[model samples]
Structure formats: C-alpha cells, structure tokens
Target: MPVDQPHSSAPDILHGWGARQRGGRIRVKGGGQVSQIYAIRQAIAKGIVAFYQKYVDEQSKNEIKDILLTYDRTLLVADPRRCEPKKFGGPGARARFQKSYR
Candidate 1:
C-alpha cells in the first residue's frame, strides 16, 4: 500500500508516514527490472515475505525484459504470510533494485 511495503497481516494498509518500515508487510511485485529469485528467497527467509511465486514462463520473462528494455532489470515478489504472524515472522534479504547509469 505504501509504495512497496509488504502487505500487512491486517490486509488493510497501515496508515502512517509514507516511510514506515512496515516489516510485517510484503510486496509481491517489487517492480524493477529483471526478477531476482535469490533475493526473494532471502526476503522470505527473513520473514520479510511469507512466500513467493516466480513467473518462470520464458515468454513472460522475455516479455518482462522487453518491457524493461528502457531500464536494466525487474523484480517480482510475493508474500504467503500476510494475515498471520505466528504462521510467519523472521529475517529475509530485503528486495533490491539495480540499474546501470544512464
């Protein structure tokens, strides 16, 4: 809800400053350029996300690349534990954004 804060356990977006860490939230679509499975894995491991699903379809990957051609990479993400903390909570590698200088 807040730009890229992960969805919260409440489903409803947290109402606070635009910069709340909102660690309990997860954003499946990290919308960058070129998805990073390992980074997503780290985020999940860190409880930053509940779970993740990758668009492994080669066509989709290519499409992503095509759409992102103006940039460098794209990032895809998801969370499995949004409404349940006991069912989730840990430390995960935060999502990352990378691009070459224009």
Candidate 2:
C-alpha cells in the first residue's frame, strides 16, 4: 500500500521487528492519514500474531504480542473515539444555530 511518508513509520516498525518475513496485501476503507495508519498497523500486527499462531509455539506468540504492546499499546487495540453526531438544532456537532433579531 502507498502511504504518506509521515505515516509510513508505523509499518517500518513492524518490519523491523521481524514482520518483514511475512507478506500480504491490505485493503483499508475510509479514514484520514492517522486513522488509516492505525488501521494498517493494527491489521499488520494481527496478521503477525496469526502467522505466529500457525507456525510458532505459544511462548513465541506471547513474546510477539508483548513486543507489539510495548512498542505501541494501540497496535492491537482498536481506538474507541468516534465523531460526535450533529445536534438537531445545530449545523455541526457542537455548533448551535446562529441567533438573529431584526
């Protein structure tokens, strides 16, 4: 996948920690730079764990998980924050309709 240079570091981290041995394509849906990067990293991390599960022993799998967590807690954890819904009387999430009096 072609990611922006600023957001390219996360994947490099995974590659540095032995993930380069495994290769596969990833397709990510909608999101901005940071979100897309997070999704890609999470997918890569999960892929690594799955690969280990299939080929390596349990101890090594746990070690990989620990290493990922230590490097970035969010690598395996999904972010919980979402965009707030727009209010009924507002044009945006938090903005209220403008007051006008003649």
Candidate 3:
C-alpha cells in the first residue's frame, strides 16, 4: 500500500522497484513501530513467495526468496531476542538499587 494511505502503518517497502506489482492491504498488531515494520516486511515476503509458488515457476520462487534474503535476511527470519523482565530488587532488568554507606 502507498505510504500516504490512512491504514498504512508500515514503512514504504512495498513501493520499491523489486517489490511485487500486485496490490494488497495488510494489518499488523501487537508491537512497536520497528516490530510492526518487521512483521509487515516478513508478511509481504512470505506472501510474495506464496504467490510465486502458486502461479509462477519454482525457479522464480527461489529467485524471489534469494532476493528477499539478500535485501534483508530478517525479512524472512524473526529475531529471537526479547526484553528481560524487570526483577524485584531493581527498577528495570539488569539494574540494581544503589547502596551507599557513609
């Protein structure tokens, strides 16, 4: 979708020259802007792969997957890291209350 579209929350990766010419709408939830963008990108990449597999030849499907991986590997793979939960002794994860003796 176009970046100016009201529901287009993700970045304008769809407008890139290598992107699929077909048009479709996507909605992503449960994350910050960066997260949402990544989710949308992965979704788009998967969708393109599926489309190629269904209508195009196997060689083209592999080509699309390779292009996406070359452009950004994360577009096809999710990051495994997550936020460490805050501990009881500290205000945040990996942080501890200061101890001062005078």
Candidate 4:
C-alpha cells in the first residue's frame, strides 16, 4: 500500500534547507555528529518500506524489486511518526501561547 499522504518531516526538511538553516546534529553511538538531513532520508526509507512491503515480491529478481532493498539499510534515523514528541519535562511538541496584556 503506497502511503496515504506525504510524510510531515519531508516538508520540514525542505523548508529548513530553503531557509539556509542547517538541521540539528545527531551524536553517533561511537561518538560523532551528523546533520539531521540524514535523519530525513532514513525516515523516508522507513516510510517506503512500511507502505510498499505488500507490493514487493521477495522472490522476484527484477530491478524494481531490488530497489526496495535499499530501505532495509536505514540505521541512522527513526521515523518521526513512530516517535513520541520529546517532552523535556513540559508540553510535548506544542508551544504555550503567550498571555497578552492589553
């Protein structure tokens, strides 16, 4: 089943890039930092795997079939949809509206 809608992070990454704002960095397990752009790619790959697994024939040797295998190698980033918003001891993924004093 193809995805019913575009993934949210796709637009976020594009907008970030267009605005010349480099994304946040992730620390590697062994120790090193990498841009969040890599995370976006991994998320996209995971989305593809989830949506297209039903259509892919594992026994097939076709070129198109082989392309699906690429999704299996995602190791850096987990899909945003599967993750809960970081609460950080406060409201999650939400901003508090400022009180306006007239």
Q: Provide the RMSD of all predictions against the true structure, rounded to 1 decimal.
A: 19.5, 3.8, 5.1, 17.0
Candidate number that wins on lDDT, 1 or 2: 2
Per-residue alpha-carbon lDDT of model 2 for 33-77, expressed as tens digits? 767777887888888888888987888779888888897888888
Worst 10 residues of 4 by lDDT: 11-20
Give stretches of model 1 more than 4 Å off.
1-53, 71-102
Best by TM-score: 2
Local accuracy of candidate 3 as per-residue lDDT tens digits, 1-102: 344253333324444534546788889889777567667767877887787789888987797778777867877787899989898887899899997898
Q: What is the Cα-based TM-score of model 2?
A: 0.67
TM-score per model over all chains: 0.18, 0.67, 0.60, 0.26
CA-lDDT, candidates in order: 0.34, 0.78, 0.71, 0.40
Prediction 3 TM-score vs. true: 0.60
Which consecutive 10 residues in model 1 have the weakest lDDT in total? 10-19
Model 1 local distance difference test score: 0.34
lDDT of 1 by residue, 1-102 (tens): 353344222222211212135456445565442233334533433331222114244554444334333322222234344433332233334433454698
What TM-score would candidate 1 get against the native?
0.18
Better of 1 and 4 by lDDT: 4
User: How are the candidates ranked when ordered by TM-score, highest leading?
Assistant: 2, 3, 4, 1
lDDT of 1 at 98: 55
Candidate 3: 10-residue stretch with minimal lDDT: 3-12
Winning candidate number (lDDT): 2
By summed lDDT, the worst window of 10 consecutive residues in model 2 runs over 3-12
